[model samples]
Target: MKKTLLTLCSVLCCAVLFAQVPATEKQALLDLYVDTQGDQWINTWDLNEAVADWHGVTVENDHVVSISLLFNNLNGKLPASLGNLSKLRILELSFNKLNGEIPAQLGQLSNLEVLALNANGLSGTIPETLGALSKLKQLHMSSNKLTGTVPASLGNLTAVEVFNVFDNDLKGSLPAELASNNNLRELMIAENDFVNTEIFSVVLLSNSGSGLNLKSPSLSPQAKTIIAIESPEDGN
Candidate 1:
């Protein structure tokens, strides 16, 4: 009976140790904590505690999966180590004070689905590597100071549903490849310096309820035609 009890205790201890995420993933989380000034976060993590006890971090089967830290007072640039969470699905860090260019390493997160970085102070052009997120659904980077053309490579997001880059300083013509995604439902690219808006006319015409919000100073006649078609009530 004594030997059996000792065996059971050892098994329990092993299970407890295994319950924690891998060292690489845990280090990634720690990098995020340190990079984003976790000490200043409204809900800070206690390094002494298990990773499962960390706020906004979700672990499953000892793998870090999702992190939802929206409006959490994260005041620094995102760490490149975030890509180390290979199983990560949703990364919601919007409404924070994070700035600096988005790490192109984020494109390494092949399992990423929802990436919400809106309502922040992030600058620099959207990383072209983001087009590698084949499984991404809702991408929100609006209300930032982003510049340059929308990466034509973003058209590779065949599974994307909502793409919102509204109220930024992005310029250049909208890529026709972007309109080819059949899964796209909500496209908000307003208040920018985009030219050659006619590329989206067919998209606007075919997907009437796709919720496209384009407002540029130089709208082509075809763009105006689609705009008129989208808002018939405005004609009155």
Candidate 2:
């Protein structure tokens, strides 16, 4: 009888010792695999095992913090469950064949710092909900089929250092508020149909310390006039 009690207690202890990751997070990864068609992926997951054992997934303190699957040939839409990774800090899924709109639920990742989704087949407008990511520092969504104007609410990302959305079909004037964020270093929006581009001048002036790489479509004559007015006067 004593042997049976000892064995049962040991089993309970072992279960506690090897507690799996949170169901929400585990399900999030599974959703990603299924939605993104991980079966066709270059590096695929064995869903029967722990998520921590999955490739390109980084976990800390039993929580997922990063998912680096760049150039992995993932083809499909990004699942909404991905936003459940509240502890996620870096999400690098660039250079994939994923399509569909950027999930607004991603704004729930308040701790996110780097969001790299460039070089995909994604289409649709940038979600304004992304402004909720106050900790975000780098946002790369270039070389996609994204359209619509740059979200003015993105100016709320005062911590942002690099913002690139070039080589898209986007149009309309850039948000004037984007200039106030002095932390910005690289602002690439070229190959789009942006107008009233005086915002770039303000960004340059405020971001003097950072190595700013500003790009935009060919400015309209009026925009050129604004740039000329904003330019420093030549010293006599």
lDDT values of the candidates?
0.80, 0.78
Predicted candidate 2 versus true structure: per-residue lDDT over 139-177, tens digit per residue: 888789999988888879989877777668888877776
TM-score of each model, in listed order: 0.83, 0.79
- Candidate closest to the true structure, highest lDDT: 1
Worst 10 residues of 1 by lDDT: 227-236
Model 1, span 87-106: residue lDDT tens = 99999888899999999999
Error of 2 at 112 (Å): 0.7
Error of 1 at 223 (Å): 7.2
**Which residue pairs collide in model 2, if any?**
none
